[model samples]
Target: MGIFEYAPAPESRAVVDIKPSYDLFIGGEFVPATGGVFKSVNPATEEVLAEIGLASDADVDRAVAAARTAYERVWSRMPGAERGKYLFRIARIIQERARELAVLESIDNGKPIRETRDVDVPLVAAHFFHYAGWADKLEYAGYGPNPRPLGVAAQVIPWNFPLLMLAWKIAPALACGNTVVLKPAETTPLTALLFAEICRQAELPAGVVNIVTGAGETGARLVAHPGVDKVAFTGSTAVGRSIARAVAGTDKKLTLELGGKAANIVFDDAPIDQAVEGIVDSIFFNQGQVCCAGSRLLVQESIQDELLDALRRRMGTLRLGDPLDKNTDVGAINSAEQLARITELTAAGEAEGAERWSPACELPAQGFWFAPTIFTNVSATHRIAREEIFGPVLSVLTFRTPDEAIAKANNTPYGLSAGVWTEKGSRILSMAKRLRAGVVWANTFNKFDPASPFGGYKESGYGREGGLQGLEAYLDV
Candidate 1:
């Protein structure tokens, strides 16, 4: 029997009413592709949720041609205020359909319904709304006397935060008067397709926003297509490097928001209970599929044992099951491949002499599931400590001082984000300055706002994704 067999299936009528077979959204219409079709599975139950068109090279060409034509004839020439109005319309439509979108996101992407409803969907709408305000105010964004749009942007987003990432990519591109051909990751493509419909509902211009769904091959074709003027990606560090090489000599402007193994540092002066909560939320939210998850927990030696005991006790209480449940704290792993990767890395941590611990809880049999795991006594050289596990796995390492903690946190090549927990305000500021990350959260972890700029430093990839900085990625300054 499957894990879900022990409980009643959650309500799915909101997702069921929507058509499951989706095609390429091109020229403001959903049209069948001339190539192949693939089925998208629900990770929670290993059930087929939908069949989506897999774009062929020819289909990519057609989409690019349409985007280019739109850029040259309609999009680029559109007034900034008009572009702003269109984004506002889309944002309003998203707000109207927020519940439906949340339900679909939970079903298609395996994120908890509470998070999809309260966090992802709301933030997705807010991102569009915030960037909409920036459309006509380019001059105020400190870009110089004038800013011009990049002709056509090709974006490929990851599965972790599907619709939200799509919003981050598309809203700014469209607000800057650039047409886009976006490819959503294969594992979670339905929300992008649904957003395409929302665009149609808002009467967005034909070819202004096109979504092509497929795996890596389609994304590569979209990014490397000669007609595309810009490329934006959010995924693994390995693929980000490949994309950098792929676009190397081309004039295609590139922005990559790649992988991260962020560190959450808890000093001796920190409020242990609050710090523990933030640490738990940082690493376990989205089942730790988040790239910016605080997978590395650095605690002061004085409180390491106390914090670990508290964390283990808290993790033991977390309920993991159907994503659509209003009460579920942890959901199924996104895919079988992801589960295997987590399993492999967890074993590596144990092999390398780190002690592994998981809560005594039952996992669902049907879907890809992993218990929230932590590795104590982890060294910086352990594969589990160094690699991006991309699951609800935390590696605990102790530090003796603030300088040591900062050194240990910045030890990795990734500099996307980090967190510091302390009651000392001066220490927070000092540590934030010394840390070489793009985003530093003081006394908190994993907080996001549409008004805040977000991205990475070093190998975590370049360019900003939110706030005023995001508009620059789509514009020629």
Candidate 2:
């Protein structure tokens, strides 16, 4: 659909009262951090949205101390059912203020309002709700007769899906009876700070969930804090390695959900139009900031020309503009730095002999933006095929057989997720089993659920996030 097909209906920013400055949420209160202050920018307009407090080493100490005290005296000591009630309250509050939160997320994180409202916010609530039911039923969760909370959990989340990633970390940790000290990415901290208010509204006790906001330094201190018993991080692989080294000899139980260069394999018998839509949704959703985005397209040689033609036509219809607009399909890049990385990699793809192609789309000149792009004639050795672009850029390579597709898909060191598009049930099963990925989608991509486990293998990091299995990440048997 073109922009003219649907009249422009932008969601109201008036719903969100963006404060001039925000403080660290620690001990169930908004406290000042000693780590100085920084501005959080709206990537869509390059506007200064809010002044965010940076968390210093001492701030990390204070936050971890608060979490430890809470885990020691209050949260972990509370009955599981009571903890569950608190979780349920937070979930309801999220739904109640969904519009406000979605608006804030769009401006701060640069994802479209349609996505923030429909996917991110809803899934965040679902995560909290899913974990709440498990609060009183940990015993039956197959962990043990009595799985214990892992004390204070230090969680660090990335910028791509800020609020949703917070839900993935905090909900289960709290539901499992652990107190948390969370550090949201510096670039997108508004929704997380708003979530702190939701905790207060839910009457969650002081020191149970603390948020310390800053850049990489803040996250580093949080993960390395001595009082923390468990560490869960979601970001880049290089950062994941540093965390692994930091917590290597310590007793801290750690789970890392890092990067991916996933493959979306399309077969000759697959539904062409349907696969094209899935492919677009896979890479272009959230401006392709997803960790498990289908950046690599492995199509059967017989259907290559047919699929590419349809895919190009579909890409042309993708509307790129204001994030708050309901009609927009692609939004701004998260930051200038991230846009630079995408630009450098896409340029590399072309330099390495890949044919670069993008629909005729004009980007707003004010803020960070990269047009939705794809590279054809890409080889296995091309940098674009091997590395995670983490943007709306797809690399297309052809395969003649299922085995070739499998080999091409698993060629990368990062095996977080993959998609198989085929009509044959037997082919789906066979390909899914053979693909070296943590999550395999038979006929779809980018589908997530609170009940299903999501994580990756290889350098994509260790451990699962959303499911009964995720409980173990925060509990001690």
Candidate 3:
């Protein structure tokens, strides 16, 4: 069947006001970078949205100094109830400006409007709301009778789910009474900049939350800064390793949420219809730009053919186009560089003798886009099966028994997340127990809640980032 075309139902760009240029938000104000500035462009149209300052070593030092000052003078001295009030205000403000922020996120980050609006924005607010409640109640959280804040926290987040990741890093740090110097990904700094505005609206104290925008060099400086008491990072495993090395032998507290190559195992007893939907949402959500995206699909040998047929039909129905479009199921890749990486890996899959298939979808002329792709007849030894493809690509492998499925699923260096689809409750429990992943979803996939702790095992990095456990990363007993 041929692909169907739809008229552009683009969300209004008027919802967001893009400034000509943005400065680093430090000590409660936007200031020029010591290093020069760079432009953040819309990956969907290759249009320059705004120019953002690149933080140099001096800039990082200034931001960290500001955070340290705030930690010592303001945030740490404030009462927990007062801190909760500020977080509550920030949460309310985020909810109020959700639409504007969502539109801006769609433009700046190239995620579909539906995602920024429906999934990302909502979660950002929820994290604040959830963590806000924990502020005054930390005495009961089991860390200690009076857990102390970790002072100045240095956080570096990734481009995918920019605002959501910022929320993940910032909310817990703030709720635990720690001041923060956050560095958003270079390509997606607008929403974090917008978040700075929200902080102003919430009347957060000066230097309590600073955002220094730049790339890896900037992040390196922030991590290495002596004033930073704790460091949290979410990015590539290689970078995570570097941050660990940089902070080694220091008293700096560190948490790293890195890469994943999660397995989605389907047994013959699974309801094919629901499993197909779960599979689609698992990898295709966020254009497969998720850290724990289910890139490996493991099917029982008896049901592999039927499940594959169903999966192909469903993949065909996905709509890929303008990110601002309200109906877009898959949006543009975040950047040209990311597109090149996805291309290189998929080419390797094809060259390595796996059967590659993609839905009949037309990519946009301008911007980075990859059709939803699947590689069948995949082996555990294949790069596509073992490596983290961080794109809309899936590697399909078949197993003959429950033992084989478990073996294949747990054969990776990464143990971030995994999924199992089966009607047998006993099997689900057994498999869930056996899977080495931090999160296991049975008959479902890709679910997240602020009340639940989320992180990974092994090379996927360390330290939990949500729920009560999240606060532990920012506290001292």
Candidate 4:
């Protein structure tokens, strides 16, 4: 029998009906934007998906005013049990429309359908579900005998994991009795707008949860808005710094979940097969756009060659093409601008004497796509190893000792996440204590749950986003 190619099994685009032009979801309804509209394209095909309205400073001000009004007149005055019920409704609605949302997320954000279905959408629902339970139990949540909500929260989420990041920002804020004005990333606003419909479906009060779509200026206006009591952001570290400076003199409570160049350390004694899979999932999942992605690989010197061989073999099998395909592993880059950043960083890695290798994977000609790439002979000083590439690119740097691995892993300005692969339980515990990152994955990589608190130390940004710790960010102690 002759070998055959796999037939295309694309998911139907009809699953999500993209509107001709979307307006800002402010107060209680979809309102027109003062700023002009922009097109959101399917990164996999460069096809225009929908026209998204951009929010100017005036729109942001209006949204914040709505949030404040809702917080004072409705959401804040509502009983805890009632608030919990509303969140529960939102969670149930999200689960009900998960398929539609996942397909839309894949189209608008360029993540594989597999991820949007299994990871993003599920986590979005899980965050609401988890925070709902906390809503009625806030008295015992360890904050204080009486905790109060911040009046209005200004939340800005990144394009990567658009809906999931919104859940991270909004669920806890709402659960804690604060109304929110959320800004989804410019490249991906469809899901957040869809979430606005979800709020209406839940019969959530007008202005309880408003979504204003735009670029950085919109976010800047939101965070700096005097009426906003809290500000939360998830994106680049440089932008996080800018937000920090923007709200410096203000009373806005800030929590930033920013960029990372997390180190994935592999010891010689680690289970090689599992370690290889962890390495792939760490950097390749979501096309490595994850804020806590393990972009830096520190393999023990004795196992470097063996680990690299396994990693290369694994990378070869990752299917990169249509994000809507059920079998696709890697998806298109989120945008042209982000692709250029990845390209520049990777080229610098090559120019600085690092050896780069990529599996022979074909990419679509029309879209922004970068293949699963790895660089050997990488040093701690190399730009690819040190900087946040935020793409499916890994820098392999070998370490001979556990102390050296720890040293190299904490060398960066980012301390969001790290993974340690080892068979020794004692060593894992010891190293976990030593690692400066906020979240550490032992034996596995990129695992997240609603019960666990997630955030980072140092420049990776501050404040927890899950579990009981997350509640404090939106609460007044």
Ranking by lDDT: 2, 3, 4, 1
Query: Across residues 1-477, which tens digit of lDDT does each residue of candidate 4 receive?
Result: 543456778889888888899999988899999999889998989999888998988899899889989988999999889999999999999999999999999999999999999999999999999999999899999999999998899899999989999999999999999999999999999999999999989999999999999888888888888888999999999999999998898788999998899999999999999999999999999999999999999999998999899888888778899999998999999999999999999999999999999999887889899999999999888899888999999999989999999999999999999999999999999999999999999999999999899999999999999999999999998
Candidate 2 C-alpha lDDT tens digits along 319-373: 9999999989999999999999999999999999999999999989899999999
Q: Give the range where candidate 3 is weakest over 10 consecutive residues by summed lDDT.
A: 1-10
Candidate 1: misplaced stretches above 4 Å? 1-12
Off by over 4 Å in 3: 1-7
Query: TM-score of every model?
Result: 0.97, 0.99, 0.98, 0.98
Residue-level lDDT of model 3, residues 208-252, one tens digit each, is 999999988999989998888999999999999999999999999
Off by over 4 Å in 2: 1-4
Better of 2 and 4 by lDDT: 2
Which segments of model 4 are wrong by more than 4 Å? 1-5
* Candidate 2, residue 207: lDDT: 95
C-alpha RMSD of candidate 3: 1.2
